[model samples]
Target: MDPIAPESADEVFLTAEEYEAVHAAVRTVAGSRGAGQPQTLNSLFEQWDELVHEVEEGYGWSAPELSNDLGCRTALAHVWRLLPPRVRAIRQPELDEIDRRFHATTVGWPGRDDQEGQWWLRRVPRHLEAETSQRSTHGWPMGWDVMAFPKPEAVEIAD
Candidate 1:
């Protein structure tokens, strides 16, 4: 499906409530392991997976289930793009760390032969790029505007 962009530069894709929910979720996961210990790749992947599930449940956008890791990863990529810049700015460091670690450790994209790395680390960026291109060419995801900011009820006009 084609991606949808906001109608104008000033337009908002997600409401403040939605942004807060996602930001809170990121904070909870980022802090789940405590301060001193470094996060393992598995833990990072699991945390991101949980975020993806939360987004799917919260927004009622069914991309795929947890059983399909690749699908969930792809959905997360789209969700990542949907987040407001501020939220992404806060999390970019951690995300970059994940990418760096994954690159240092893994040979290539996770597959039947190389399943050691987090699929998201390698695949998500590609998805993000594709989403951006689609958004530029097409627009934001279908129904996102309505979902994010629903129109108010119409009143009857008197003659």
Candidate 2:
């Protein structure tokens, strides 16, 4: 890999369609997951490297290859930045409900109150027993908590 050449005023770049094909190829390889082969974001970049080589060999005359590894990495980083949220939209109300439920049994009073303290302690055993019994029968995810939820991208507001 060579250092990135500084863009000259007269240099022409490849068409958008050519680069987009490379990006699409990366997505195609990433999505074709196989048994015992869990893919991560790094795997996408690795696939992109291979695609870049193929593209360079196949279409070098018309579509100039990206300069180097840095170019390939930067191109994919740009693609990722432009991507919309990949996770499902999480509602504000649902997040609020999770927050409420998480804190519901806590004794907020500054001073110790026997009844306030005891109420939560009493609920713990019942909640645990129910969670244990329901887990296997209903296939409820064990230790399902707000922290376990995948964070979704926030809506971008235009000023």
Candidate 3:
């Protein structure tokens, strides 16, 4: 099978070194919840917080955007997708509670827009849903498996 080439120069493929670096950064940011321990909502929320902080840093900088970089985005998406079904199930209520608390305290604060207040709370869930939908529709994003060489489709020439 011939390897699949990037259709354009704009597409980013991680080299072996870059893949390892990104993988390590992701793991460092998305810390583990003890090997055998059951994941609680708090633990999951903590993980979400850490992941968001890492991805959303340098928000106004002119430097390369971490949120849009293929390797960083894919690595973060991979971590988000790894959350177990039970943890995913609890996400909405947790998010709702966060929104509730934010609004509860911020009520009557000057110029506080609901959308602005809720943006952080909603970001991860929105990203996860988009990634899940894309995966279902288009299969995994290209460069998802950075370590593996692309495989070409089999062809049969008709005589």
Candidate 4:
């Protein structure tokens, strides 16, 4: 596919050199300070301000365009978003159901096999924590992986 002419209308129209130049420049100047995080143009730092100008003139693109679109600007903007006052939330309503089933079954079999013997087949709800830590890496936003378990007793018996 020719970068000078996008393969499809949905793609951004630019020359190959233009695309590579902008992306390369973004990577080059986005994190020059060695601060462990990408430097964002939104910051009021004098050096970053100067760097912004250099990027615009260097890439023939404006600062706002840099922020509004993908490329290194979008990545840096993502970093900025993640570096704010945001609390990560975890959904754990299933924990309550797990407790209920565990208690109900164990208590019902109190004298049978028995709760006193510490031996009872338990078939209750279990779920994994689905929480995402509010931290960005490589200018990417934070994310999470979820794992859910079905209630054992609720399993359908095969006919």
Candidate 5:
């Protein structure tokens, strides 16, 4: 089936060059400093912010017309999948802090059972959940893979 046919409204096809350009820019952001120590959560968070800009530039230069809704999702999934190994790694202490913040956020968050909560939950990274056996009883929602770097405000509150 052809991807760009009028009947395939939900599909957006990228040229091989476009796909490579977009993903390469994202990978560069993920590995800018080379690999060694695992990237800190805070550093990864900063890099993710930078990556957003890079993705925009990549799409702007490579395939502006193909940058539709589905294309955006594709780009995000690609970014998540291509995240550097160093960036995906998290240590025990940071994992503990993530658990603490997750629990704290649930308490008093009016939208805990609503879309906002779902959005927050969607960002929870697979590595974070994989480490769950080391701390708490629950794991992140199944199939989650993106890094959900915690908001500092959520963890700063005393419970």
Candidate 6:
């Protein structure tokens, strides 16, 4: 058997059409499920049809002749889910990267004050160790206790 040569980047860079097509195929494959309550691999070929459409639509994809890359593997990631008694799967190192970069990016506390295009997020301090409110005592302060100290010099009694 002969060894296959690798695909050059010139052959596979993404185009707008390719983007749309691959997007559509991946979307379809992602959504496909079998008739079984749990579903199985029957939809994989259906998913492959999707992949073929994407390739034919020219998102810079040529049909796989001998070898492939993450793109094909990603398509099959969905396909793998559909396989009956499926054991094989592709592991994506970049799934971590994609999760890090893009997953749940829209999640966060919404601004408490959204006025005049300003979004102010409000958070209360969780716990303060040495916090206490001043007592509302109505009387003596610093001078009150000082009054107890002897008058510096009693004003000499007036004659």
Instruction: Report the number of the highest-TM-score candidate.
Output: 1
Which pairs of residues have clashing backbones in candidate 6? 18-59, 40-82, 41-82, 41-83
Better lDDT candidate (2, 3): 3
- Find the 10 residues in a row with the least total lDDT in model 3: 150-159
How do all the candidates rank in terms of lDDT, highest first?
A: 1, 3, 5, 2, 4, 6
Instruction: Give the alpha-carbon lDDT of every model.
Output: 0.38, 0.31, 0.34, 0.30, 0.33, 0.29
Candidate 5, residue 118: lDDT: 28
Tens digit per residue, CA lDDT, model 1, 2-74: 1122135554355566556564443444443557653332344556545544433332221233224343344
Model 2 poorest 10 in a row by lDDT: 121-130
List the candidate 1 regions with Cα displacement exceeding 4 Å.
Answer: 1-67, 70-72, 109-159
Encode model 2's per-residue lDDT on 2-111: one tens digit a residue.
11112357443434553444345445444434585534334544554454344333312111122232233344444454333321111223323422442342222223
Model 3 per-residue lDDT tens digits across residues 103-159: 332222123343652233222111111122222122322222221222111211111
- Write out the backbone clash pairs for model 4: none
Query: Who is ahead in TM-score, 2 or 6?
Result: 2
Candidate 5, clashing residue pairs? none
> How far off is model 4, as Cα RMSD?
23.9
Best by lDDT: 1
What is model 6's C-alpha RMSD? 28.0
After the best TM-score superposition of candidate 5, give how far the Cα of residue 119 lies from its true spot, in angstroms: 4.8
TM-score of each: 0.31, 0.20, 0.24, 0.17, 0.21, 0.18
Give the alpha carbon lDDT tens digit for every residue of 97-131 in model 5: 43344333332323345243223332211111121
In model 6, what is the error at residue 6, expressed in angstroms? Answer: 29
Over 1-159, each residue of candidate 4 has an lDDT whose tens digit, in order, gives 213221345554444555454444334556543466444332312343343334333322222332332233234433333331211011122223333443443222212443332221321112211123232332111221111222233221111
Model 2 clash pairs are none
